[model samples]
Target chain A: MRKLALICVVMVLAFLPPPLLGEVDSALLQDSVTVDLPEPPAPPGNVTATDNPNDNGRAIRVTWELSADDTTGMKNVIGYRINRAEARDAADSLWTEASDILPSGTTEFIHSGDGEEDGPDYFAKNYDFYYRVHALTADTFSVSAVVGPVQAKDNWYNTGVTFVLLFVALFIILTVTFVRIARKGKELYIRPLAGIEAVDEAIGRATEMGKPTLYILGLGSAADIATIASFAILSRVAKKVAEYQTPLLVPCYEPFVMTVAQDTVRAAYMDAGRPDDYDEDSVYFVTSSQFAYVAGVMGTMIREKPATNFYLGMFHAESLLLAETGAMIGSIQIAGTDQIAQLPFFVVACDYTLIGEELYAASVYLSREPVLLGTIKAQDWAKAVVVGTILAGLLARLLVDLDFIKTVFEVSV
Target chain B: MKRQIPMMILSTIGTIFVLAYFSPGLEELEKGGSIFFDVVACFAFFLGGSNLVRVHIQKIARHNPGWGYSIVTLFGFGLMLFIGLFKLGNPLGIAGAPTEPGSWFQIIFQYCVAPLSATMYSLLAFFVASASYRAFRAKNTEATILLVAAFIILLGRTQLGLVMTSWVPDWLSIAQIPNLAVFIMTSPNLAGQRAIMIGIALGVVSMSLRLILGIERSYLGSDS
Candidate 1:
């Protein structure tokens, strides 16, 4: 029985992956990296250790020296970390580490309460604080000589920061829940998005001028949200063109998007009672290479001289080039993209520009889909919650700064 | 029937992913949703690649005007695919990953693919300069404001802004063009960006809801 058990154990051990060894040497090394820090400097410039402005007698600010040897060249200085300790009993003591890292060659740092009253360096009524600094290098660590055995000051919020944190968390949770519930049946009213609103008129103008409408979908595949949104808007626009018996041409960079666009445009045509007018060849693939696609699009635009150009989907720098050429041709150019970096370019050259989220919203507004309306409403509620948080944070800062409320939270700096 | 089932699946999966963001205890579901999307996208690549090859092959067979370029494209595509798939010239042989160092696949990617992509991105530099020159003209009040803002931002990004405005006193620092530009971006520009972002979020929510509820079915390639 013992031999069988041993054999089974060996088999399991042999099959186990490297990570299951319970000896994560890499992680252990990374975790222990905190040991490497510079030595703490001596207290400097009127070290008036007193009660914290808001808390009870627990926290103190320790300002440090302009250490001359703190130069990085003479010694490879990584950073400085502050640590505090308090005495618990005649034989026992406790120490707690800080979270923040300050760069070397800095003159001052603030050391505060570790939240334990009876721990190391803490007296019955006053807390005695001791501090040490650690120095760090690429692979080595050194600790400074201990400082303090000094009384600590306390603040009020040093005890109550937890409640404040909890309140903020609860508020976010409630707001999000309320928003989701509210959105289920609510009607969201969105203002007319110009890029979407112009679709019909642009197509109408093209039809009247006996010119085809040119539409180019960028490099994004069908699964990209921007591409999906673009296709949704395209379907609406294509339907309008179909109803007016206007020609619509689509050039796509990604083959998946091209296939989807073909289907979408064909469906739109059919829904408009113009299934016969649907031309499969009108929706075709361009090059997959970014610039190659751009070149193909520019060539098409120049040759076709389409009266209205619709540049939609996720565009990059080619946004400006396409918009500029469209502007040069005096096409009723409308462009929409979610890329914030490319927005300014489109805004500059396009006749009507859909900036950022407007491209996403354009689809909902044009389609009037109920679920979209509800989701918009929910998003509004979420925004309201965000606004509330900002307001609350500001209010808390003001109150804390003014000492209107004693800082009871024990988080000391 | 052909598109309806796929559209339904798309709508269902899309909505589930959105709901998984906030709905209780669906972390794994969200991960699965992401994996689902990746699978779809991965499969879709075959479609894209096949289409590209088919188009070029047809063009070459037809002896089209761009047939030579098409042939080059086909050869390039085939070579890349073969090298990557077979792990050719890899230090670890066929068992080695394609992107591993010292692999022929890695060489082609580093030398050919990465440089070409970077070159394409670099074209943005020349395009931006040209676009700015053409677009930044004083035609109206709005245009004039835009032009001035553009100049300040452009100058601020370069070292000349500091050189030009470094003489301003500390009290009048806000009036310095560089500081002013920074303030405008951090304040007004950030505010505008935030507002647009909010709107976009709302729009996304609405779009997602429609997709989930099957209210927007036109993408299904049929109304019925």
Candidate 2:
């Protein structure tokens, strides 16, 4: 009994000492905790803030030398924290954290703002700002000397895109020179496209078959280059349709495109002396939802089975579906698009395909205008220049391991 | 005068937009122009909707071929419009957005429109197979090369490719189906796409110049 009592007392002594002497033990624990605390990382140096160039006056670029401990000394820096003066001429000591704490090794940060005067993220333009760099460790930080009084502002020129400017200028000069040359009655030879030749043939066949000619301006907006090009082609086709006294159906994907098509058709009919025959119902709007549009168009194709189908404009995945449907219905499909991915699908299903630049050239070819021809010539010349540069760049890389030529072609945007 | 005014507007706006590319601090102007276009397109949406209704109603009145589809289209359009505007069956009531949970608008889209759209999109799978079949037919030298490349690609996508080429030595790994497929795609295919892209870029530039200079006016249906 005495031994059991002794064991019980021993257990109580092992577990109950801290609670019995809690006040005295707390002081000792605090002292030990203070001794193990982490030291602050060394301060970074040479901090600077400057106006970011080639942008609206909304951001300041802050940079600093790396903390000594980060690379060579204690290696304790987890990251660097950036703080900016909240207002113009605000004291450096009174600052707001600019962004998320930058991870270690980055020595620069673009302190951007929301570009609004009232928003929480706003950093006012033409406002003076100061910055401080804090080398951070797990539990403490060492602040660098303040540096700034930098004002955010904009630059007139974006030097990063200087190469782009040079190319654009060259193109403009070339285009102007060729256009002037064209105006002087100089003949420019443009290789004939099979698709352009087939347009008349397709229309004639549709006329003979006594069926409608379906002209889809595609799903592009009225402003799209391909859609604009198609408008020219459609005008010519509408005139021919009027001459032949044949039906021409134009189902549009966009409302504005439909309006434009209606105008072009009416004008063509007027030109052909068949203004009274022009029906406003001929050009109508369809839905804009992608697959729904496809479903609607497919229904028309299956029902109408138009003798000739002309799909000319910007298309997407629906290109294959539409072309394949046209093919199944045994329609003579003449397709044109600058979309490279859809080109293969069109080439496969359509009787004739206008690949890439051919779509743009189609309208010009039909119009046969000197000014438009000049632009085509300019395009060819530009393509030649691009090809020549690529060749030269390749040769330089292959021969002397020179990458200098490529740097000239590297556009910022 | 009709053509001249539009051309002038086109050239002036086009020039300013082009200038914005090379100049700083003009981004706000571009953004404003983009917003203007969005507002115009938003208005155009009503034009499209009204036209849709008018066309379908005409079809029904005339009892045209496929008049049944016109009824279906009109019903779907009207029902969706009513449901969306009223926010009927919305879990959060009228205060919530039209697309909120349990709304009839969401339900119909989830059940009807989306599935119908998917059905149309799924047709592409069968269409692609058919297209590939025709595209891969060995009719000529180019077709033969395409067939070979396509065969390699199909094989590479499966585990059988690794097993089939396992006997080949590591030094000749370039000849392996997977590696060959990747090489064809990244090198030859990319090169062709880039070439086409370059041509397209020049075409866009040329076409834009013509429009901006008012050298082409057929799109406006003008003879002069």
Candidate 3:
């Protein structure tokens, strides 16, 4: 009877639930008591979305203030996540994750769509999009209020460049006013460049020695500004050479330059009333390769032993090579280039060096036209304005802690 | 008519480009102009190549001075052109890139042209020495200053500056040779360079305006 009773009790005990069993073990019962979990981070505030300015459209810039709980109170927030949707009242399922995970303290996200016309990720230009930022803890998230219905579209004009536009307009007005003033028969004073003075002397020396004057147009294309400026100088030089009846050798690195140079020499000869003396073969095309051109010029320098060498236009590493070779041959070297890095080499190796703007000024000095002289005067005035502005800005910053002058000149583009 | 047409075109295009900077819509005009220039330049290469051949051939035929060098130039030019055009030794066959690795053209360019270019470039070392010797003669006050600056810069680039200034105090560290060299470069030299750059920028702006307004016409030769 007792054994049967004990078996019945064991069967009843086996049918009991786990919680009832935990009552037998105090440690298990204590472990079963629920403990409160950490709260999710506070939602970020002042969320805003706008079309990204100065872009080709298809992008929105989302910005928000960081969450309060992100930096203080528990400081459990790890990062933030950005989400976007096409509909304003979109459900959580409809919201697409724009950013995977941004570190805490981040307040901006550029939600850009693929630039493709047709694609799954394509955000069509001029389309309205809504954005939300989620402040995240280890396991919980608190989302910000929906920012917008912001439409992304291209701007016809970038407002950020307003200051630059104003400055440019001012310059244009100043230049035109000065140009008109000079056209009224006012003689604009242009400081003489030593390089310009040397050009005539070099040509005269070449004529006296009865040796050719070698002129290298450098390795720039005809479209290059330096090369274009050089053409003006070359015309003047060719005219002088023609008047003196001295041989002029021009080795061009580009065919277009060669053609232009040929035409320039021919015209200069005609202008000098010595068209019969102009040789078509004098200004000829050399190999377009930089080093090959250098090699050819070096060979010419060695063989021809020119009395004067004129290194002008845009020169690169070969600047010193040519200048050194000319110096070695005991020829007077005159060089002019806009390349600043090559200036030191030319200054060291050549008898005369046209430093930076001096090249352009030398061209103007050679042309001696009223219009060109007017431009130089305008340029000088503009430079004066720039210098005054810079000095004023510096003094203001140093003395009064004012930055408005600096801000005025700050170019956005 | 010739001068007027060219001037009108230059003014129109220059104005368009300047306006394009402010208007994104007209940006394509700038790009299109650049593309047109590039295409024209590409076409000009044919003229350049032909002229090279013509000039060299004339020299060779007439037995002119340095005619032997003309033969070498022609042979090299012709051989390279033939190898590149035919895509000889190109693993991917005729349509492959002429400069593809393992190709005859690539081999020749890598082995011959590149080395020759480097050799020529290396000559600048010797040239710099010669130029420096002449320029740093200390003939005038400015030349003396330049010579001293160059010497300091040279010392700063070597271990000698560090060894010489190793005993300098922390307070006067900037007066040390290396530090002074750096100051000269970063402060005075940089200021001078910036000043020059500003002048160059202004010059470019003025020159561009003159070109656009048809005031600067020497670029168009005697027609202007």
Candidate 4:
């Protein structure tokens, strides 16, 4: 049979001596490597040097047209080398190489300096320098004409982010207008969120069950916006918890967040007139290591069996781990995060989930201050504008083949 | 006065930060701000470390419910700190990095912490399965649609889908499981995610404006 014969052949090949098998291929490799040398390739053309834009004056941009040999000619050009010097006729040995021979077909290089002052790569700003590129072959190279006397200087403003400036200006204008209206005693309507509505219910469940509520301000530092938003929600939760006199556990991942949470909780208890009952140990610092923190929280959840778990902050990969653990413990869980990737996991595991902007909206909605409401309304209008633009842009691209909107919003780094 | 002073300072510095993005002249100021935060974080780290020790010691002294684990935690924390601070068992001495290869700190991190973190992270695989099972159940109309889509995605990711639909004609290739899966992800899934991202971006801008303008202050604890 063909199968049996193929197996036999494979066994024979596998059992063959390694040297005997490699001999044929090794001969072919040697034949390939003993290639005859050719004349030097054509030199690269039109070398240019200019100060790099949008940076400190530490770099110069060098570019050249590809050699004829690299294109429609012999096609033997392997790569290019860039070099620079200060003098007009510096010795070939004195000119420092900018980088390792750049890979084949490279037409541009950002010749920059870094780290040490006395090193070969020490290119200072505001210096008149000359640059040249070499088109290389196997054994020979042809050099392009030196382009020189170009000085690098820093630009005070990054014109690349002009689109960003425009958007920020528009947003500020819209926000200020709405905020003034709101300050004039107008009631701005915000759609009710299920996650915000469930805050009281989840805490009430914990109160009725006589089990503590666990609040996790996730792994983000205090500077994170999600953590900042969570602080507002936590203040609201703490007020309710204090009024009900329910046991509350807040384990924080960052020390700064922990300190802030302590202040927030203490203030809430003072406001609720229950400062006497607010335990200092109620909010404490956990380990800073990610898994260690998760494990510690998991241990507490298993031991205490808290009736409600509120995870409201910037959770990372541990979103599902925390949520799944809570689900296993049969606790009512309400979670919110701005992380779009983690939303699906939270949606699956938690009883109530706040998706994306809802996390911020919850804070604004809960506070109900005129200015906050005004800002939220402004954000809504911004969203509507973006939606309309997306639709119009799609139509423009499809029917008219125009992409001006795309170009207008494109952010340059 | 206490709150208002800080609010005023926040507004001033925050406005500078916003301008710093577009103005290259403020680039150095931005880096300086970051360096300042790092310096503050070092102090905060000490607070977190001391709190860890104090909380654990108190729990151990009082014989709390999980006092046994506290001892292990303290011992591990103490050992790692001692080894790293002294650079003990490092091939390179004070001149080299504390985390030099074959050093006690690096060895423990590589063998112990890395594996433990990886083990915890790998637990996500099983959790995903369990969560997806609950999520993909056909309890409702939307759930049924999700289950079907998930089924297609699962098949398309493996060799089975190619074998299942390899004979489909070129004109009807879109009906192939792999192509269908790609369409679902790149079309519907991507569209939804982009919509959410736009909303999230707008929210961040609005929230940042509130902070910069001092419209929202509950984060400073009930001040709103």
For model 3 the local lDDT of residue B217 reads 74
Q: Which ten residues in a row are the worst by lDDT in model 3 chain A?
A: A28-37
lDDT, each prediction: 0.69, 0.85, 0.85, 0.86
lDDT of 3 by residue, B143-189 (tens): 99999999998998789998999899999999789998999999999
**Residue A286 of model 4, lDDT score:** 84
Put down candidate 2 lDDT per residue, B83-169, tens digits, no spaces: 888889999888989989688899988998899889999999889888787788999999898788889988988888878998888
Which has the higher TM-score value, candidate number 2 or candidate number 4? 2
Candidate 2 i-RMS: 1.8
* Model 4 bad stretches (over 4 Å): A1-42, A72-76, A89-94, A113-125, A271-278, A403-406, B5-9, B159-170
Over the stretch A55-100, how does candidate 3's per-residue lDDT look in tens digits?
5566789999998888887688889999999898998899999988
Best by TM-score: 2
Per-model TM-score, in order, reads 0.63, 0.90, 0.84, 0.87
lDDT per residue for candidate 1 within B1-224, as digits (tens), equals 77668768877777666444433234346567777767766675687677667776887899865578778778888998999898899999988888899899999878987787677667667767777776788988987988898789878878899889999999999877788889889998898888777666645655555565565566655545
Report the C-alpha lDDT of model 2 over A254-364, residue by residue, as the tens digit: 988888799899988988899999988889887888898888888898988899999999999999999999888999999999988899899888899988888888888
Q: Give per-residue CA lDDT, model 4, range A1-413, as digits (tens).
A: 96576556556655788776665455443443454445789999999999988765678999999999986598989899998888868899878888788977889999887424798666676889988999999889999998998987766777788877777788889999999999999888888888888888988999999999999998899878888889888888898899999999999899888888988888788777888988877888887889988989999999899999999999999999999999999999999999988998999999999888889778777767887788988998888888987788888888888667678777765
Question: Candidate 4, what DockQ?
Answer: 0.44
Off by over 4 Å in 1: A1-190, A208-212, A244-249, A253-255, A276-296, A299-306, A328-330, A368-413, B1-12, B23-25, B57-72, B82-96, B99-115
Show how many residue pairs clash in every candidate, following the order shown. 42, 0, 0, 0
Candidate 2 at A300: error in angstroms?
Answer: 0.3
Candidates 1 and 2 compared: the better one by lDDT is 2
Error of 2 at A204 (Å): 1.4
- The window of 10 residues in a row where model 4 chain A has the poorest summed lDDT is A28-37
